[model samples]
Target: MQYRRFGKTNLNFSVFSLGTMRCLSSPKNVRQTLIQAVELGINHIETASSYGKSEEYLGEIINSELPVSRSQIHITTKIPPTADADKMRWWIDESLKRLKLDYIDCLGIHGLNTWEHFDFIKQKNGCMQAVEEAMADGRVKHIGFSSHGSLEVIIATINTGLFEFVNLHYYYFFQRNYPAIKLASLKGMGIFIISPADKGGRLYTPPPALKSLCQPFSPLELNYRFLLSDPRISTLSVGPAIPKELEEPLNFADRTEKLTIEEITIFNSLENHRDSVLGTEKCSQCYDCLPCPENINIPEVLRLRNLAIAYDMAEYGKYRYRMFENAGHWFPGMKANRCTECGDCLPRCPEKLDIPKLLEDSHNRLKGKEGRRLWG
Candidate 1:
């Protein structure tokens, strides 16, 4: 596997890191996948306190099955923003306890989705202070933050010169954070990518246009190759459902073939026609244009829309849509159908998605449908 220096942390991280979001719920599966990942030379594993039993599962594997030492692998975990100073400290200790580790290599503030969210971390008695305390106490080696916020918020956070690493949504299809990646590198901060594949739900089945563009190469390889082409990316955290999915990217890690100029040009051309290429229906889950003045969760609505159509899970989509619509904290002003096309959200979109149009389409189809189920 190809390894890259992880910013100022002084650790060489594998290009493909194991993400424990889905695997943690199944302890046996988690053990098997993690052991296989280590055998495949994937030494970096990322998890969160909020991702069910991920930490506990990792602890079990380390304590029971894996021969790997704490020094042999890098463990990255996160704490939620709602966790106050006391709560954050408690959670970090809990994470360490669950992982059966003395220290976490990197600890991030999980799910910083808005400007207000960033401000909350900056508060004296809030998450940042809690993280700093962890660092000082040797509980955490490096401090970081994971964001699904706008480029503006990311830039603001980077400029503060506080964090040792930053995790954000970045991939080939969604290059909105490209500049931020460079900026973070310039400042010597670790850059980690989250869910590049599952975010769009098309890594396994590339949109026909993208597949045709890639030709002989599988869509999954093309996706990982495109992300790895950028040297600034420290690691790509993949949420693999099984061992094979976890090992797929490792196959191409050390290969020498690179995308040619013409190939890159053709790929770039797809950007202009992305909606048609990837289908406007499949939400990339790039929640950049948020804090919707009307409080519409443009990304979540698009995700439900895609799930409804891609899997024919209209009832399931409607159920989730209703949850969001009814939850005052999530989506306030606008139901899916209530978007007025004010176009205020357009400029904020790094992906340049047409929000009003998407919301209208989703509400019309998903609300009245039945028998929707989760895709297998």
Candidate 2:
């Protein structure tokens, strides 16, 4: 596998790193997958304390790979953001014990999904102190954060200069984190993109249109290539559900694959098609038309609609659309059907889109019977 310099941390990270989220089952299976990944040159492994005994499984797996020193593996683990430094340090110690390791290469503040979580980490003697204590004790190396926060909130966290790296959600379709990613790059922070497959338009189960648009390579491979193409991105984390799921990217790396002319043509065609579909109504996602009394997040709804219509990613569109129903604060607010003919947003809309009408049609098209069942 090809290696890249991981920004200011200076770790030689493989462009493809392994995330132990999905295949953290039956120590034997996980061991084989982890070993296979390492043998295939994936030197970096990412896991979390909250990912269902994943650290424990890795503890067993890493030990089994004899002669492989802890230095060679480059392990990273994340804990939830806590206000109490003592509590946070307890988790750090617990993660080391669970992983059966003496030192962790990176410790991340996980799930910084709100401003409160962000501030919690910054408070004097708060979570950062725990990490600093660990560093002083030689138990952890670099510090970072993983977030599902808004673009604005994420930028705020990145600007704080507290982290050496950041774990975030960025893919071909979801460009909301573009600003944060750019800022992190400018700050020389390691940028690790999480959930590039499962949360990334479900490329694992690609629609026919996307599959055709990314020919010669599987949809997942195409997606990987797209992310890897961006030099600013340090690595793409692949959480394969099974061992074989590692093959495509591995083959690409082993063969040192580059985008062929035909593949470039396919990429252009898809871009053109997306532009055509969004003509005169491209959602810049600027949130200019917001604060609907119905409490709807108009931009995200329209973004999901664009995904459904632009890329034929109907299932992805439906899944995200239904999330608003029960997601509470985790998601923004009500669905598009709640737009009660208020002309207040029309004047604010930069695209001057028929907001209510587009929303109703999108609700009709994407919210199918399956979505209703999931929400119920």
On a 0 to 100 scale, what is the lDDT of residue 11 in model 2?
96
Error of 2 at 167 (Å): 1.0
lDDT of 1 by residue, 165-261 (tens): 8998876645668778989999998889887776533566455544665566665776677878777788888777777786666777774347768
Cα error, residue 41 of model 1, in Å, equals 0.7
- CA lDDT, every model vs. true structure: 0.75, 0.83
Q: Candidate 2 at residue 328, lDDT?
A: 44
The digit string of per-residue lDDT tens for model 2 on 1-376 reads 8887788889989988999999976887788788888888898999999899899989987866734766788999999999999999899999999999999998888878888898897899898898998999899988998987678778999899988999998987788899898999999999999988878888888999878767767777767777787777888888877788898667656433566677677778877888898897767687888778788878888888887888788888888788776754446578888889877789998778888888897888777654443223
Q: After superposition, how far is residue 276 of candidate 1 from its true place, in Å?
A: 8.7
How well does candidate 1 match the true structure in TM-score terms?
0.79
Worst 10 residues of 2 by lDDT: 367-376
**What's the count of clashing pairs in each model shown?**
0, 0
